[model samples]
Target: MSARITLASGVTLNTQIDGPDGAPWLILSNSLGADQSMWDEQIAFLSASYKVLRYDTRGHGQSDVPNGPYTFDDLVGDVIGLMDALSIETAHFMGLSMGGMTGLGLALRHPDRITKVVCADGRADAPAPFVGMWDQRMAAVKEGGLEAIADGTLGSWLTEDWRAANPARTKSVRDMVTATNVDGYVACCKALQKLDYLKSLGDVKIPVLFVGGSEDVGASPETMGAMAAATPGGRYVEIANAAHVANINAPEAFNDAIKGFLGV
Candidate 1:
């Protein structure tokens, strides 16, 4: 069920779709710099029972990055367009980091398309401290190229101990990051600069499951707890020994939690 889709915007999304039909559809979005393959572990287990859709965001993996300053609407449109192309009406949505922001955008603008939303290791509001990093990252990626951020993204994506213990997997993720195009990465960074969803968070009405990594420095559980408190029927869970990509860091526990949350 894996294929390449040409979106209306001319970006070719390299996607992998798995599992049964009419079952709960789980759409997996990636963190920054990586692509659809990052969700390999979750797709393996969930696809047997639930339809799992995973793809690269603009500027990453096999997806095409055409231009700059892409808005949240553009990202959401890509998701909707993919669903239209695939004939999907409603599906369970889940994302991490930038992907979480995408999910938030979809919930705010197109609530009817989502069955439930699960945002892991992401923020509803653009934290101020990250702005500085965003600026530096843009400059580095624009100047030194994608390789400049590969090692750093690798370390931040997972804990030091985890990376040391799983060198092969770590290397694979790092390679994905390093292979990214500089202009594409910088363009997404610009999109990040304009992203803020505090006003829109209150508009999302679907059941929301907030998952966080115990060691996530970017979007801490404390912040996710605050987000959960803001939204009714929001349940927050923290994955132990994980950082940003908890699904990759702690696959079994993460999958089990998602299965239970989605009731799959």
Candidate 2:
């Protein structure tokens, strides 16, 4: 069922809850430019056997996308608040890119609330050159909104071979990106620029699984490896031929890795 959780920020974020009620919960958080829909493939694979919760972040998907600049705490609070509203005391949390950063925030800020963490195609710290890219993206989104950046954004997300091999699915994903709100897009870009969680990760005692796609353009294997190395018991895994959206690009492998991690 679809639901809404009113956060301490006074903002109401939309979410969806499905799967077996008594089963362990697996929450999927999407990348910055995408929504919870990115995990549609994973949901199809995991929902029948396990309880699955997927939601749009503050400004992405069907959720509210407010004005400028949101903090990691803001994103983390959304997940925590959603769990509270759903009566979920603790959950196995997972995210990609921006969503992964939010997962890290929860692991650090509310350690007791996460059973384990799976960060796919994400980094603990933003790479040096990415700061410039984020600035350019924020400016472009602010000026022209999501449409102006949709094509290039999609271009960077999927490998050229995947786009060539799966034009239909690629087009569908691109359409979703174009449909996002410009204000929300820009706000997330600004948030991406200010992201830094090197210290926070040091305190993440929960088991963490870092999955990086060999073809990932967003966060490289080297970077994600560094992120995993930072966590106490974090381990890194690579999905062959998968890009930024590993769950979409490599659903079977993504599903297996996550299922094994959560043991559900």
Best by TM-score, which number? 1
Each model's lDDT = 0.82, 0.81
Ten-residue stretch with the least lDDT total in model 1: 194-203
* Cα RMSD, each candidate: 1.5, 1.6
The TM-score of candidate 1 is 0.95
**Candidate 1 lDDT, tens digit per residue, 70-90?**
766777888988888888898
The best candidate in terms of lDDT: 1
Model 2 agreement with the true structure over 77-175: per-residue lDDT tens digits: 888888887788888888998888888887887878888888888876665688888888878887887888888877667777878888998988998
TM-score of each: 0.95, 0.94
Question: How many angstroms is residue 132 displaced in model 2 relative to the true structure, after the best TM-score fit?
Answer: 1.3
In angstroms, the error of model 1 at 50 is 1.4
RMSD of 1: 1.5
For candidate 2, the per-residue lDDT at 128 reads 68
Residue 250 CA displacement from its true place in model 2, Å: 1.6
